[model samples]
Target: MDDDGLFTIGALARRTGLTVKTIRFYSDTGIVPSTDRSPAGYRLYDINALARLDLVRTLRDLGLELAVIRQVLDREISVPEVAAAHADALEVQIRTLRLRRAVLRAVAKRGSTPREMNLMHKLAKLSDEERRRLVSDFIDDAFGGLEANPEFVAMMRSAMPDLPDDPEPEQVDAWVELAELTQDPDFRAAVRRMAEYQASERAQGDTTGLHHDLTEAVRDRVGHALASGIAPDAAEAVPIVNDLTARYARTFNRTDDEDLRDWLLTRLEIANDPRAERYWHLLAVINAWPAPPSLAPVFAWLTEALRAGTSSRPTTV
Candidate 1:
């Protein structure tokens, strides 16, 4: 400290743990202007200047820009307000970095080709609203203007892919696959067919909503048959098939006869597309929803059982 209650640039550096060049830069930038000049033309700083230099170093360490720090020093903005704004900005940066990490991890795990990696990164970079729009457009193409099952359409619209800020690699993969699947012309055609089938049923005055109870009944009965190793064509499956068809007959207000079996078989065939099941699976993965049990096996079992039962019947000549 000098006798005039001031310090030279080198003394301020030693006290503040900053190099003389950095202190000099801050002084030159008017962030911590020197309070006086020594007789030899050396810059000298008073205690207030020293305090300003400390604040400048701290703000710089916190990733604040020079202009913002200048504003802070000039009292153009309060420190608390600047801190809050910077904190919000940092949150966005953190989220972006986390998403980048997830995309890189997905690329590494998948050993993606250059084109595939490019696509993954592009999909990952989409904003949440953009992501939802991609799915919404697919849903619209499939069911828009068609009187598809209202409950089922509502379920599809509501179950959108919502990738989190810090997604897992699998979630990233799921999102990429889902984005591709929804954009696929073939898959879109298949889903549109399903929508058309539902619309046709509606035209036939079949106004029943989604039969969750009937679906559960099928899943439960078929899952048990599968676990028991009963073949779909085996005689043991007859009672199980009878029980399920009876339940479906009651639910759809149809007779438990050959005609009903044929109709149920057709319904199963239309709904049994593996890609359709995959659509829900990918959505479940991306949204971090509880993984839905695979319905492909259950539906396959029921379809085969219905077919086998139909084949055993005598043909009308």
Candidate 2:
């Protein structure tokens, strides 16, 4: 190509778009050798050198180290093998960057404090097993060793939250909130108290617990009533309330008496706690679980309807 079937370093630079300094460095490192020396002692390369330089440039663009690129050019290892290994490394890098992006987005949305930001970063970096163990430990502390009803424990475990490798911003926020909730002594105590009460109920063989078929009945019937804008204390609510009370009584094999209604009202009151609702909501977010409908509105309507019905009774002198 040049005067004598060899191109000078400057000529090769022009052809490959690499700088003369770069080509000379590659030649010095024996990655791309010069085929001859000109009369002025200038380095010159043949067509083979030009192709090797191109391969080196391409590999560099792909984030391969120079040493590895040299091995690739020397044919000591196949290009595909090196590319495959680099691809796996890049995959890990991409995952880390994605998680960092999610964490920063969450911080931006919340305008979190420095301390909170630090905590979020730490939480986002946990391994899958670490995250699972953190959740499992929390559940254990919250409901463990209270002679918890087996069904109740199983349900709690099933609802445990797990962060995916690539989480959305809201999912990251949900995970951070969940981790904080698990660490709160008050929350732990509240859940434990409920667990103990449920265990005691199970022992009594009353089994009238909300977990029974009564939950679905109340959710469906009361949900419909609330959607229709029926006032809990209105006369129109009487039939709905009566139907719910009858269903619950039938489930427990008891008459729908005043005392039974009172007990049911108390249980519903406990079940409607906002913290418990938050727990389930967070789990749904982390695990991408389908959200169960809010039962608070229905429970509140039932509570008011039950009280109003009780108060309308004629007082005997």
Tens-digit lDDT track for model 1 on 131-215? Answer: 9999999999999999989999999999888999999999999999999999999999999999999999889777898888988
Tens digits of per-residue lDDT for model 2 on 1-317?
67677898988999999999999999999999999998899888998888889999999999999999989988999999998999999999998999999999999999999999999999888887787788789889977777666776778777766777789999999988998888888988888877877777677676543454677888888888888888888777877777777766666555624477676676666556777888888889988989877777778788888877632221221
Backbone steric clashes in candidate 1, count: 0
Pairs with backbone N, CA or C atoms under 3 Å apart (clashes), candidate 2: none
- In candidate 2, which residue ranges exceed 4 Å CA deviation? 160-166, 206-212, 224-246, 253-262, 303-317
RMSD of each: 2.8, 4.1
- Candidate 1, residue 194: Cα displacement in angstroms equals 0.7
Best candidate, lDDT: 1
